[model samples]
Target: MSVSDPLLKSLKRFVLEFRTTNIVVTDDNENLAKLCSVLEEIFQKGIKKSKFFDKSDFFWSWVAKLPSFSKERCNPILSMVIDTVKESKKVTLDLGRGRLFIRSALMKKVLTVPVQIIAKNRQLAREVYYENDSILGNEILAEILQSLLFELTEAHFQLRIHNASFLDRTWNLPIYKQYELVPCDNLGLHVQYINGFLLVKAVEPGSVGEENDKIHAGDVIDELHGEALRGNKMSAVHNILQRYKGLPVHIHVIKGYDSQGNLYKPIHHLIEDADIDIATADELLQVKKSTSNGYKKPPHTILNEEEAEEIPVHGSEGGASHEAHYLGYVSLGIDGRVVRIEDSVQGVLKNHTQRVPVRIELTEKEVLVIDIKDNKTLLQHAYTEISACGRRTDQLQHIAYIAGETSCSLAKKFNCYVFEMKTNEEARFALCAIAQGFERTHLLL
Candidate 1:
């Protein structure tokens, strides 16, 4: 079971980096071998980049050797895998964590789900020991990262995308005026490269009449608000976001295919966000801004569309002392506060404003801090340049600095949690890198 836990985690981690690689888990040895052959045949774009000779090793010892506690601590997922092995000739991997094993014995192929991967950190035991100075040790860390990545999986859910807006009393009729804001989730535009043709990652929550028919994750979206589909997904988004800022817009989509050849179209809705209560939905509708609501007050500062084109570097910071890998989240210190929503579980029940998810970069003791829009100016005097604060030095142990806020100790804001993990110089240095990495890399809203 110990090995099972890490293997699952490792598989999850591997999948994130190599998303298009088709994976098939089987108890049969021959089937596993055939999978490798198929993988080399179809997943060729960068198949050569990821092939590790030992990647397919099914040694039985690896199954019970998780790095966590000596005793078995992984159960839920184990139960599921065991059940899957008990039945079925094959299995289908859901986009999320749970696996569906096909059982033909039942009249209809019964999809047996025995394990579920929730989106939460389940550090089975204490943090694993790692020398900060170690090389970008994927091997030593592969199992750990793999285990962790699987934890980030969750069941599919809906993303109630509505028009995003800002309120302002400065323009139009008193009730009609709004401060123009960039189209966020509400901005009737979205796209993610899956099977290919620059696509939009949008869908109606419930199986609506016909819209549901066209929605699917990998569907190639080839159209943009009447524009002939040209360029990639990000390009289309940049164009639409610039024009639709602070306005109501409609979007149309179709299934798309990648240059390498994979296709998917929606026959059902794929939910992808936190849940909301009916009352919250109703309230949101009442406050929903529309074309008639008047243009919203313009935002004072916004992410420059051009800047996004520059990111997505698959490599790490130039020749750092140690190696780093892309974790797929944008990290930055916007000027904001370290905030915690009070009674968010219940408060968000009717007000989704509280349910919007964001990441808090963690410190040594696990204290989280982030840059929000407001107080970021605090970094102005204390530092020059952007909102984050982490300067690396030769020694692996160093104090990660904070951007802005010259007058206060950014470390103090975390209270007792701040110093909990700074037990030694090495720990402090690791924490510094983590703090800065989180701020500079976390995705900004």
Candidate 2:
């Protein structure tokens, strides 16, 4: 059998959307079955044949079994088909840590078949309820079945490529490069110890470290004179550098940014004032101004009456002041003697109930909370460790709170942290960003 002209035309339009060359359309059942099997393989093993409407009986039975067919419940499947065919609506499906979206009329028609079959069979009761010509014929159905197979194959292939691109852009392993520097008077580099890594905080001009074009402020000094600098204190690193003064020191460094402009993960959290150049400083100032504008009042409210009266309002005379309050959050260190807002959610964190004021930042792999006053890192949780996050409803407008739970590896316990943002939009943005980060981490794995 051959496909009818009407069905062939419809199928060709769908095929053209994928821009696939060497088009072939036939009504051979064996070829159609092979195509369906290929689609199943592409989607991975054990995908139900009914998922793509490969079997005629299964398709009909699925329509008959729909809860919407009982008239009391609404049929979302039928509604999706109608919306997709008429308005070119698309539907997203979660697939292996990524998402797959489809917006084809032919696929929608194939999805609507079972419902149409059930409705027609019900109306044609007491008579031979054969397949209707208006809905779908056998030959045309074969062509559509083949078309859907190709559509899904192409869509899945594109989704894989997209996910790979995302992984390439977001998650990058640290690439180490070696540089041999001969100090004249000094190495002329200011270094800081952060999370057990020695980071080049600044490179003085006319120094060997600055002369080396590849070295930058955020580059990590992984090794010095073939000795690992990790887990070494600043004094130890200083002693090593002094021992090798005026001598060629072979060191291994992790570049802050790769050739393709991908930043190292550690650079995101360890950025300091010295790392900011003129252009970057201007950009950061603009961002700070915008963030400060979001909250006309302070980001946190003191629940204790005595503390509230004692502490003056921010920007008022004799008010408590600190650097980097750009986001309107109080810049209290982790151990500062400030009374914090009590957490509304119980048992989120063991022996921790106070919602401390801090600045929250999200990277591609982890969420970092930094003290706004001392710039100390209070919490760092990988996305894999974070089980879930969402907004808390007990707060007032413009005072959005977010809570996330992280599983501790050493203690084998869950620790929950709650953050307060200036606006509801900011809270939602943080929640979505974390969710996307979590999904990307799993996709890479």
Candidate 3:
């Protein structure tokens, strides 16, 4: 039989789990030879004497060599292999979920093969065996052994350790910067605690932080408003920001990159001794309390009763709406809004997959797609017209929905509208809102 035939048969008969088992073979030639001998016996039994052989044929033949290879037999073989390599002081075995992941404790190299335990009747069992790849020749076996042992030897480990220590001692340097930032729209800074410092993860576009040009993502905020941020919880940072709301705050940051623009070594290398602190409810409550009392309208500030009543707040009773900025429809060729569809809107969109800036708004009864620059409604669809709406997983920051064209009855059809959001989280939120709109419409019906 051809190689493809038996491989197809095996796949159809048994579910091939792509899970792996890792084993670290010793650098010793004697142990490697013994392991190769055992593997050769299995491969010779399965492979027919032929000039040409494929992976599928080799795999099936190996399986046939141990038709009754059970969990009991699997453990002993793995233990024996482990014992043979134990003298190297680099063997580590991780067994779980009927799988094994073997690797050298000191090296980054790894070899993965399926080690599943199945039944004699060609049926899958709860266990697995390490079976894949044929022991074709001594060269192949020698190559595999060499890869596992190349950097795992004692001499290599000692040399690497010495080099790393020398570099750390001689090249370590500190880079710092100070910024005076005025708070605008919540400072627009999102931070995460990493390596004992509050690392700025993102800076919101158009915010004061971004406008400053000095503050940036990846910079570690070592001190905020005269308070050292290191060894402090995120809540502490929040509390400090809240206390100094609407005021220019002084910030001292340890630059993630050096003066030469190259990233610092500590940013990429793990610091084993850094302590990561977890936030508690008390800290969260303190942040909320500080925020509530942080901002107060000036004594001269006053609002008319009508002005107060007319001011729109999101999610309010008077038809409040949700809006998000998106890189507009991929199907639309032009950057501007589609004010009128002289031809088929679907046809125009289907012609190309280009994106432009747009603003999406969800109102009481309709969804409006507007051009960001012109501020004109390009396309409007009622909740009832929407056939489907969802965020695309393939493009994490993209959202897609199918809606029927209400205008131009001559060629009325459903168009797939695709828009890319600023972030995946925003895309997900937009999808959820669209789903809620559908649900509300269903309830009204």
Candidate 4:
């Protein structure tokens, strides 16, 4: 989100060092005033450095219109401005009441510590933050840094990881190509100390180390920028690299661990199955109805001869059909409740050869059904288990008619009218009711 403009960079740098520490854009330009207002807000809010310029896009566009404000002539100044923004405590220039102040008390303290030292520290902090990407830094420490250094979480401090590139026979080492125009500052390499000694834990892909096929996992960082780095912490190595950002530096490494293993791996996650059924609505309603009748009726098996004769072993295959998207199959309990949902419904369906029988029912808001794939003859064999205490057609929220073959092997098509349920609880209750209804309706064959 940086401006990437030279004149603005130079202006900022000049303001940073100006004795009076006040920048007053004398021109009666409204854009200039608007620019100052944004700078004030940025100082107060202290947004992340990467997103700082996002809110000032229009102001930077105005800078582009300034005469003779070419980026090439002021490249070095731009670099300086960028470096200050990254490392310094807050921006050097402070705009307030239509005036800019540069020599803030915080800026004075940082200036006392040589620019290179501050830059090196900031660079190391940035790298460490990226390495421990998921963890958040301490908020109190962040305020103290004033944007110079963000505090690290304790978790990152515990892990020992070394980032080093190695040259070996297993990796076909190639001589690094020379780039005459731009200095080879970013070799895309990082080094570290794992265990007690220096160990190379990571090598970025497509970097100088990886492309040259020189650096590999398990390599020890022997020296950095010509200085021996044995037994040194990764922070020390970061300091060395920081001072030579745009320069080519040689790395000496000793082979250690095998180069065959991957340097880094992705984090894994575990998915859990949904727990569906808990209680049934019919049982609850029966208990309520029994309580209202003055005395609790002893639970007894019903022997309704005429009603029992109507029970069919299996649902008729030839029924009214409807084209509807099949969401997935669900299991219902005795009182009409959803008990379980398949992990990969489509996957199971695709592998299944035969149509899975399901008894459908309706809840207060949604439709509920049971996948009878495991119990092919549930309608016939399980008919005797359930009690026919009571039946309420008004409680039935929906009627899902069999529309097509229930086998999952075929492509998905609308085959049933699924009644809508207001909530998951209603669906679960409805499922249980339908399950009980199925048993009550089936014949004992």
Candidate 5:
């Protein structure tokens, strides 16, 4: 309960040893082993901890990479954890499968207990070091704490998305299975070009595309307005849309399906060709022939002799830059990371209850459409109300609150739209129209 508690003490010791002394304990490190044991006990013996592993990437990553871990570990551990949690009565673990979360007053306290102790010591050490240069402690303790907190934040984000898996499963699946119309509003739909195909990523909920079921995530756009979109970059799609601003555009899409006509779900397949040890005689022959024909090895390929050890190859879900204005009001990082939809604007209906795609990048510039799932309830509130889009021309200091906070809040009532200006002065007009249009429609109080 207190920082002086035995569990907290052990946690602090582990952190200090992990950061300061590096005598190379690795998998055999007693401190780390003890820490893992403690975590295992908490997960197994503590009934309230059952929801910690549900769809958690951090938990899954640890389970996948740790020794003596298996799916079987879950059932018994979860059962015990539940009982322990119920008996203690100190913390209440609400098993919310719909949101895929374990909510308890003690959960945060438990996770942060170790970090808090280390952080306090770290701050003291920092002050001591400033006064006396010989003072001890790792300089990177703050970074470590920050990293741990970030992981917690990311894990929470993942859980929310997993709980809201219905949108993609029920509504969006139809569009990918059969042909559907994707609405392209005044801003545009979010998309990414991958492997010579353009796929729709997100759509605003109340927008024409979403309301009419014109577009859906995972539908591959093969052509736009009779022109083949294959092999073209996202810029090309932008260009074609800009060229014909208001015309009824015809888009041909390759619905997600297999050659067998079975519905295709997104999957991660192992790279059989990447396995060197399991090559057959025919495969060896092909490799020899290919080598003889002047095939050069890839640049990053290291000779086996120069490598210290073989690093296991894992397949990635893939990554790409994503943006969508057509779906419930959402925006992404220019680099394509999913930015929070609710934070984008007011009245845009920010539902932290749903799951939007967090980044699942494979290579630096590729994204597999299947990797992104469960995004319907996200930003569902702001579909039809957006009246105008605009860019903030003010200083950066004045922009965050005005653009992100003020404008979005205003949009909820007036249905005004504001967007980052990209060589277009139209959004400014839209902002003005929002005020004028509202005043014209109703007498001011």
Candidate 6:
């Protein structure tokens, strides 16, 4: 469908609702008759997915706020709409065939953002939302669409973490100028159709590469590790960045350059960490410990509930209530706004399948010890399934045994993991590890 189809329908519906007799035959008599005919056809046709089917009634509550609209006169149309959508078993089956709905989550698309039209053409509309929140609704469609759009627009705002806070990039000199982004968790050093952002977590280590030189926990991250600070896709630079933890990246005061330059800016000089007393103290301890997940060599390892208990607390504070705050963030790069995990539930739509999170981020910046959180991270991690099969990431053959199905294609479609209750502990860990951080590749065990 052409993109204009959506706007066209809105146009037709808006005209019809004006009920101006001079424009057409908008008479109380004609309206009542047309309304009846329209209603009859709708019930008979079962609400065809029309280009002109203005779901006005769905958002009519907000429309009602308009002064010209009359609740009394609009009753007939509203009544007819309600009766039409109030479905019977056969009607629902015919309407929503092949819909993969999650239990308790299937919601009517009823939320509407109240936006005042600006400018003459009404082309500029801004959503009205509370100062503290974004104009997002609780639906997968909104999640995907809004997130995609947000990222696309956000990519334009080049971020600069100009924290000359740390004065130590003694190693090989800070490459603030040689800027590029390697793929991160869901983002590869080089990837296409990136759904997440160029998540840059850096710290300015006091020391250098050596543990002594290596920036400590309190160091401030200078560059997004030398990224141009984009929420869009750019492959001119390298695609993968690894061993990022415990490394203090240099800060380059990179200014946007001519498109002709290939975005290569020489590293800027180091910024002094003048008075980082407060910031330094705050940086030492994360608000909460991250959901720590790593196992000894022997892949597919498992340290289930019983084994996990003995793990001691890392620091002194052990009984804290608030652990950490983590939120799922996706970036569409240039596309802006979060796109739907196009195939979040790709379990062979016809067959059942499973997938695991190669990496789970329970905390963005927190250090909760096992004793303090009582393994809450593990609980949340356990519930974290490979919710969606990404663009082309596939599964492992062993997953076939877990799913007990001959074909793996089913699970491959949704980018999900398949695990069994009867599996051993090691198998569980493998799935968990992939869910935590599938480095260089996605493990499909």
Scored by CA lDDT, what does every candidate get?
Answer: 0.26, 0.41, 0.41, 0.29, 0.31, 0.23
Supply candidate 2's per-residue lDDT for 299: 21
Q: Which stretches of candidate 1 lie over 4 Å from their true place?
A: 1-281, 287-292, 297-300, 304-307, 312-445
Q: How do all the candidates rank in terms of lDDT, highest first?
A: 2, 3, 5, 4, 1, 6
lDDT (tens digit, per residue) of candidate 6 on 277-319? 3322233232112211222221221122211212221224321
Q: TM-scores for all candidates?
A: 0.18, 0.25, 0.24, 0.18, 0.21, 0.16
lDDT of 5 by residue, 1-445 (tens): 1112244345455555544554443322334335544433322221211232343322221222212332223333333333333333111222222111122211222333322333445543332233222212233433344344333322211111111112212212212222212112332455665544455555555443332233444445655655556567888878886654322234555433333333334310111212223223343344345544776432210011111122222234322222222212344322111111123433333332332342221222211122235543222122122222222222111101111222232433322222222223222222222222222222322
Q: Alpha carbon lDDT of residue 273, candidate 4? A: 15
Mind sharing the TM-score for model 4? 0.18
Where in model 2 is the C-alpha error above 4 Å? 1-171, 272-445
Which whole-number lDDT from 0 to 100 does residue 356 have in model 2? 54
Model 4, 108-193: lDDT tens per residue?
22211222222234542342223222111223232332332111111011100111121111112111111111112354555444
TM-score of 1: 0.18
- Backbone clashes in candidate 3 total 11
RMSD (CA, Å), candidate 1 to true, equals 24.4
lDDT per residue, candidate 2, 1-445, as tens digits? 3444443454455445444543333221123323332332222321223422333222222333344444444456654543332221111212211111121212332433432443444432212123333223343443454555445344222111111111212223344566543223356677777756677767765445654243566777777765666667888877886665433345667666543354544454555433444313234344335444662323222111111112122232211221111222222123111112223222233234355556666665676777876778876777666543443333422221222343322223443355556665455444445545554565556
Angstrom error at residue 96, model 2: 24
Candidate 1 lDDT over residue span 1-445, tens digit each: 1223333343444445333443333222223223222222211111111112123222111222332322444455554444443332211112011111111101121111111111122231112212232111123333444333343232121111110010011011011111111112233324444322343344333211112122333233333343434334566667774553322123333323221222211211211221212212223233232212653322111111211121221225311122111111112233222111111112222333221122233322222332233322111121111122211222122222223322232422211011112223333333334333332333321
Which prediction has the highest TM-score against the true structure? 2
